[model samples]
Target: MQKVTFKIRRFDGEKSWLQEYQFPYHPGKTILWALSYIKDSIDPTLTFTASCRHAVCGACAVRVNGQATLACETLLDKMLDRWKTDTLLIEPLQNFEVIRDLVVDWEAKVERLAEVKPWLIPRDEFSKETGCRQTPEDFKKINKNSDCILCGCCASECNKLSSNDRDFLGECLRFCVSGK
Candidate 1:
């Protein structure tokens, strides 16, 4: 097995530092797997957040080699090919508060979404007492927009938010609005 190094930027409440660790490489394993290995076997203090190891939960998003992406969805082989190296720099997503190793505070995004009122404001029903019903064809048209898993990947990659000049509603809210 080949050796892979993960250079992680760590933040505690008082300060920040870089921590490095190495692991055995297996083909087709994801960054999440490597992180889990580090946390489980190497260092118990290494903290990150994840649930639904598949891509559905969006809880495992972190910056892999400086790109905002889901850890479960990113393969180590592909990342190694892209960067031509065995060392991967994993960091918490940009444009948010870093809670620890790879977890970021999502309160700002949630608070912003609250301001936008992302819930459905139903249209008047054709049947006076019931809710409006959408046809199959109408549902199909907007189906792709509903695929958003609220991962905040778009928010981390947003040009406006990255600029740190003005606060902007993230793409997740925009996607919700467009879908409705």
Candidate 2:
């Protein structure tokens, strides 16, 4: 087991602190695993949010060494590689308030999706019994956005969303609106 140093930034409602930890890095080591190890055997004070250990759930997404990625999906090598060359700044995603450590206020991202009405507005007479009829071609037209898991990754990196103006819904809007 290779020891990897993790310098974690932590914040509660009242105060903030930095803590360094060391963990064993294996071939397929992930950021979530590192946090888990730190949380378990190490400092229980460190706090974050994670779920579904797979990338399918967005709950574990955080900025790893300054780049936004799902913690469960990103390999430790990638993070360590970047860290070795430069100091890895692991901060919560921009444009959101830090609830604690890596966890930030994610409600705003979901609110943005709600603002856009991401789902298709039903036409008159479209009934549940009938099920909104659509062919494969219709799906092909909107398939590009079908993969959206509401991970908020795009919003995390979006420059426009960082601005104070709340009107701009950001890139997810483009994805939602792009009917092609």
Candidate 3:
């Protein structure tokens, strides 16, 4: 395709609308790059959050065609191929308050997470001075859970949260505290 089109859902605190933008398509470009290109070259008013472009930081997570994915790691070509279209619908993650165009508010989520007491209470064997050391096997058990970057993807895709957000803590926070 010569060009790719993006229909992005934009919110400015009170009002919400869909804004369309098109740009020349390039091979091996990621969704994050496309967002950056639009913001930098096309529309300076566009708002989104991204950091640690390596995908370790989940700040770049967004709903691409109704599914939550890390924008930095998702290739535009892959999305185009998967959907068999040149146009993509981008929206803020579901089950969160939208702060701006594509940015969601984390303040409430953080507050809810704190209610779970996600931290561990140290045993008498482990103290601040000596520090706690765990065996490789112990670390391995919680390794996968520790990888959660709080990107809100799991929460966004969670059916339970969509239905009853007040009761459900969402998968990400559950997994995070479960590991601890």
Q: What C-alpha lDDT values do all the predictions have?
A: 0.83, 0.74, 0.90
The residue-by-residue lDDT of candidate 3 on 1-180, one tens digit each, is: 899999999998899999999999999999999999999999999999999999888899999999999999999999999999999999999999899999999998898888887666567899778898788997887777677788989889878888888767655754944545
What does candidate 2's lDDT look like per residue over 20-48, in tens digits?
78766667778888889889998887788
Best by TM-score: 3
How much does candidate 3 score in TM-score? Answer: 0.92
**Over 4 Å off, model 1:** 124-132, 172-180
lDDT for 100 in candidate 2 is 85
| lDDT (tens digit, per residue) of candidate 1 on 140-160 | 766766677888787787778
TM-score of each: 0.87, 0.85, 0.92
What's the true lDDT of residue 103 in model 3? 97
TM-score of 2: 0.85
Error of 2 at 84 (Å): 3.0
Candidate 1 local distance difference test against the native: 0.83
User: How displaced is residue 145 in candidate 1, in Å?
Assistant: 2.3
Highest lDDT: which candidate? 3
